[model samples]
Target chain A: MRSASIAECGHEESNAVKETQLLDIHDLVVHFLREEQVVKAVDGVDLRVKPGESVGLVGESGSGKTVLSRSIARLMANAVIDKMSGQVVFQNTDLLSLSERELERRRRKSFLSMVFQDPLGYLNPTKRVGRQVAEALPPELSRRSRRHRVAELFTQVGLPGDKASLRLYPHEFSGGMRQRVLIAMALASRPRLLIADEPTTALDVTVQVQVLNTLERLHREQDMALLVITHDLALVAELCDRVYVMYAGQIVESGDVETVLSSPHHPYTQGLIASMPGQRRRMNKVDGLVGSVPNLALLPSGCRFRSRCPHAFDRCEEMPPLMPTSTGSTSRCWLSEPEAEGEDPS
Target chain B: MSTRPDQSATAEGVSIAGAPPPLAAKEVSVVYRTRGDFGRRTARHALNRTSIEVNYGELVALVGESGSGKSTLSKVLLDLASPSAGEVAYHGKALNTLTRTEMRAYRNEVQVVFQDPAASLNPRQRIWKCLASVLELRGVRSQLELNEEITKLLTGVGLNPAESFARRFPHELSGGQQQRVAIARALAMKPRIVIADEPLSALDVSVQAQVLDLMIDHQKRTNAGYLLVTHDLNVVRAVADRVVVMYLGSVVEMGDAEQIFERPQHPYTRALLSSRLSIDASKRRIRDRPILTGDVPSTTAIPSGCAYHPRCPIAVERCSIDAPEPRVTGDGSSVACHLAE
Candidate 1:
């Protein structure tokens, strides 16, 4: 039914629904336990990414978007997490149920790969960048073939494939070049799904555009599903066909990028769209949402965003379930309730 | 307000008409000598002969990508870093010519807010101390008076129940709150000029609007000139009265915000404007946008002639041979592009 609804949204490629979902997350909740309190990082998020589809998870710093992505990639340490209950189904197999050895095997097979924000921190300072990428390549092949594969990956990511450039250390390359090398490393495995977390946030705008172009082209040619996790709505609008707006550790709204950005129902989503600076011609003052993200440890009852939401009212005191709105998208807000639609809740 | 010395009017009195701009960089150039490969010393021209000024009641946005020398230029204007070949004038008087007392007064008049609030603030001190020290330096001494002033400062920045926020350490607050505290510290001096370098870059998008609003609100109330050095054009479009576009250590374009946004002449400015990803989903896709290819060349090896000619879309033989001088167009916008009509 979800796939059918997505198909009805008039995506360019109808075949997206026919293919099995590359990744489907159900009721994912990740919480960290401190000395006494539990940090409710991700509280019940349901996300889906169809094969060859680019999905974006948009949220601010404390919105649990990063935690959700880390949980999806199974990068979280078991000891640190106090409560984690979710079904992370990847290509028909539940990733949560897999043993460490089995997961390692799957990771080696390149079923999933992730590129992080800080490229310099991820790359080895002493080792040549090309060798680092070559190491991520399958060890079964001879070193000569591995080097050839590394060069091919470099070319794919719009980086220089020459031997001289490959021999340089991480410090020698620019920030954008270093990020491309990391992307090349992630691409070395030829994974079906690529999870890029704030990939271009560290680089300059011009460099950022270059890196984004490379990612867009790679996504097109490789036919890989992309899950871009970022705070930038503009980036999501540019890259993803579908988007999920997360707020205070929960998905507030989910729909096609066009519908969600254009006619958002959730108050948090509305505030986010309005808060974006560059949308209007000449705005004297941006009507940014008041207050900050609620403290996860001591969250207020009912709607997580009520304190900051301008349109929040009595109905928001109770937690609103994620329900389908008239716009064919799901929104977790009382304003989108069928009977309450088209009326000013405030 | 009347008790404090009027530094702008008193300093030098060299102005023919009214007082000069609060802070101005007149053809300032900064070069750094660094150890290169094999222990060789190389001179990196971080800022070319760039000129910009912040008036008493306007926000001037200095925008550029990384390595464009926007940060270096901001430092030069703030008098944190001295220019190698040019002068930074504070109220019509050159900084070099200022007396000891005059220099101290200049420091009080011009306050700065850095990108990372956490780094700028003292982690060991409570929020109130961070603000109180600056106030005490300005001659607010009594404990009761200090508390009153700190409360007013904290409330002004939107931290409610200012007493609680003042007691907490910097680490206890979020990035946004810390930034607000940083803004409060800068405001404590009642500065005539504020130099904020990438103040919103470290903040979350939602929090950025609130902080920007606070800064603009304070600027209007105090009539303080602001030199906002940032890479985000959208923020520039929203708050800046005037815009200064920098590219490869040079001011590629300078004009009214509306003129720069609506009808940019420089190719670099055009590219920068177009390259910005719009939140409007109906806008053109990344593939369709005219994205400038290649990273900014290392400042150490800046290309000869027009620094932007190699990446510029419409470069001719003359552009590569001779650098184009800045020319004011009929619209009153200054552009340094050779092909700009």
Candidate 2:
């Protein structure tokens, strides 16, 4: 079955080889203005997603992965942004250059849609769940058709699409059901690219598996590109084809999911893999990185992870560029540099 | 429930061999009664006859999903909520039988670390003041001694250059730092038993590992019994000496962590283990594991017989009519399933 899926993926990729990337991001920088300090949430970063490909963006809380994703959807609040630069190209169009009205129109046109972590916060508590999903549909549809489309979308997301269930309020649903409702709303736009940010973090393990299965099925059946942003390595391994590891507002590593997870080159990536509780047996101490994430406003001059990195040296005083490794993966660490005068640590 | 002598002996060897455990809940149940429409009375069985014991120097993990009665069980064990049936005991002494002075000592010996540090810690108080209040209750009154103890606590939790951290309020510190302070506060009393409820769920994975290491290191140093209540199975597999699996107000399985992970007997245990997403690429494809069909049934209207029958993949007609009593297997693990041998 796995080999068959791989063959299918290869066939799909070849068919879309001549097409432009589904989404392309270049040197994107976003800084949040906090009183006297500028929090460099997302420093210079580049990422891309091919058509119908699933990409995973992995990071910790303050690693700027969220900021990077929000910037792509033009979801960041303009009031707090001190500086924003770089181009977010979606479907050969510079989304960054588009006005608010145009972006709204584009969003309504099913170009792209995003699902956030908190399901309850996005849904209207007072409005019927069915009507909320219907609102995401195009305004041209008749009321009867909109209701039918909402039910179909609900069924697609594995939720009860019956009239009785549709009339229920947001509070009446479980956490997993509520998340499925949000996913139904995202799918209502019939978007080509779906961006789900920590979609299953708030759910239980069993419920998470159910939701993941739904997502995988939808992605395969609809031929939609998916960008999953989460802190879970296991989630990435299970759902994404390729992954980009973000740390301190930079892409520390990017490669095929199997390759990066199995044999990571960046020290930060290695640390993350090592810290997973599943890697060790009962009572064995996990070798977690020493310090907390750096303060964004007062980030270290050189490598931001140097403070917590065990192998930090004088060379680390200068930031290392994201360089290609022997395994066809990119890593931003001096240790992975081709000409470095030392044995490869990974 | 007939007990075979050899099996009972093995069970006694694994647990309850010598002195009494630090904390134990014996057949505890909690039922919340509320008035419904038309002045009708309704009783929700939040916890149903659950028994758990945490021995000194051991880590016991209570694993379950939301509304599975894990939190209700924790509340009962902490003596914060009185059990509708059964009892909570400390060192074999029932909580209700203890004198006022003994109860005060019991309160001092049991410390709790909550899930969210921001909500748990006093926002208005500085870090030192939080630890100081706990110390003051322990009868350390002098200014110089309090400061020294505060510094020591901060250093113990890896907040080095402790003096600087001691002056900051809870809001000033990061999530990890605030959690460290909370851990420091919990450890200040030098309690024999610590109850941490979803302690690492709020933080990132890296910070989670750090906080878990701190907890494990402290448990080793102090030989304190730890009852860790959480939903993450991976964390439980890493540190728990014993595991208790709860579903819809009842414990379906309880056994040694290794045995439970490697050879889970109960169907619910098997499903939960299979559902866990591992960081192995070879297992990437969604294989045909026994994925449960639906959500956990409501506690207010629990299933007639086996609470899990509705979602159990291999459930039989008997499962819907008769609730299986917990039976000990040859491996000394207890499973509440008729099919478990």
Candidate 3:
């Protein structure tokens, strides 16, 4: 387990291992020009999601989680993404290599799909939900068959499956039901993988529970890989089998949710977990990280989190790799490096 | 209703019983009349016979789902919108019939910090300009006095080196900084009651903690009561002394924060506690707590009877026919569930 890393598992033992890769994002970099500054939103990130797997990307607002998700979906044409380098391999083909027309064709054929945070905006207000859900399906299907399929999808997502529901407008549905409608549309394409970005952030606790249950049920029944992007680590623990903790546009930690969350190795991850209120009986005064996320364009020379990290040392002047910890989680910190210091100051 | 600045009760609950509560909404009900898609008009019951009071130096959290009338109650407290049925009182005086001058004083006494600081702060105005506009009410004559007061306010909210932040526009500041400025503006009036409507929900996780600390510290420093309207239970647990849970515009449960969290009586309160997904080890074992099903009924067509009985797992047939009145429970909490006892 000492050499167990994403890079090692992806490259060194790739040929022998038969864990079907649904989507492999290697060295993904997303840079945007904001006010003449080239903000490196996502810098050299490597992530993988296999078939029937559920992975989470948890980060704060400026951590570039949204940008990374949009970058993978190739939906950032208008976002002014100056440079998007790296490979977004889906199933067998590199999505970055495909032309606009080819990408559109592939996307239409339903290799993958996405559900955004705002269902009110994603759903058409004037049109009936049944038509919108049916419209997401390939046009080759007969109109009657599409309606039947939409109803089935609606049932799968736990919406009322009656014909009356098909006639309802987007404005008539509740926020949670509208989100379920969007999910129904996302599943209409029958994609092999689904990316939901902050799907429940706008909802209440009870509604969030309903939506999460829907996503979990979908992941279990359909077997489509789930990539959930959110700032809520608690939601991540509930839905994801594995998780990636992102900070300042970098994957600081990644591992199974059961092990990584219970004992997060990275300082940033530890601070994030502690900051959550109501998790403990007493409000642990050991308040979370001291400072906010660093500016992307003006990032520090060493680790981006060094400025806010509590246990910084001289060795932290150099960036640490995402190495495996003894706890089976890959952490991007010098403290987690077993051979770095003999005394184990941490 | 006993935890005021001067008066104290049994010490077990935050009952503001004898304290002519600094800010309170008594039997407040707001029904907005809007024309529907057809020729017919409809009524939306945003708040229905809801009463919430905040003592001079207390932190009362109004916790509920989206359409649970939390925002409407905040508005009633802030005097932003007048309730149709009942009255809001401040300092033992009914607010609905107050004179213009008295209302102006009330406005200054009760300030608000909104959810989106960016939207609340004027984008075209600099931080100093925004702060100065609020200070003008105090009649600060000299430029030096104005500058000194503005800087002091900024520093009070933890934005140090205030001169630099003063010159910057709202867009130039970060979300957390903008929120700090908003809090500073609310604090500038030397407000007695600050109605913070989901102040930390827009902030990032780390920044959320810092902002929460600032708000709590502000409450401690000024003895200014806070009516915190938020859905985040974590925020409630961290700072709120009393917790009020609303369901479809009605107060289903209200009690001390510890009693509400540890031993929730109402089925809705219990469901809300279980629905929370925290970073605690106990969260995983919450599978036994039944997750209430069904969407929250719309405010326009609030359910009859218990309002929660449609989704309440323990609801009996009697629940749907008769509305349950709030009653005192053993935990020193007031629960509206007929089966709570």
Question: What's model 2's lDDT at B97?
Answer: 76
TM-score of chain B of each: 0.95, 0.93, 0.92
iRMSD for every model = 1.0, 1.5, 2.2
Task: Give the alpha carbon lDDT tens digit for every residue of A163-241 in model 1.
Answer: 9989999999989999999999998888889999999999989888888888888888888889999999999999999
Best-fitting candidate, scored by lDDT:
1
Best of the two (1, 3) by lDDT: 1
Pairs of residues at least 3 apart in sequence or in different chains that clash in candidate 1: none
Full-model lDDT, candidate 1: 0.88
Model 3 per-residue lDDT tens digits across residues B18-120: 5477677888999999887785888999998988788877899999998899998998888788889988876556786666776777888889999999999
Best by TM-score: 1
Off by over 4 Å in 2: A1-18, A341-346, B1-18, B35-42, B287-289
User: Could you tell me every candidate's TM-score relative to the true structure?
Assistant: 0.93, 0.93, 0.91
Question: What are the per-residue Cα lDDT tens digits for candidate 1 across B1-341?
Answer: 33333546455443455766667788889999998989898989899889888888889999998889999999998888999998987776788888777788888989999999999999999998999999998999999999999999999999989999999999999999999999999999999899999999999898999999899998989888999999998889888999999988999999999999999999999989988998886778776777787778888988888999889888898888888889999999999988999
Span of 10 residues, lowest total lDDT, candidate 1 chain B: B1-10
RMSD of each: 3.6, 5.1, 4.3
Higher-scoring candidate on TM-score, 1 or 2: 1
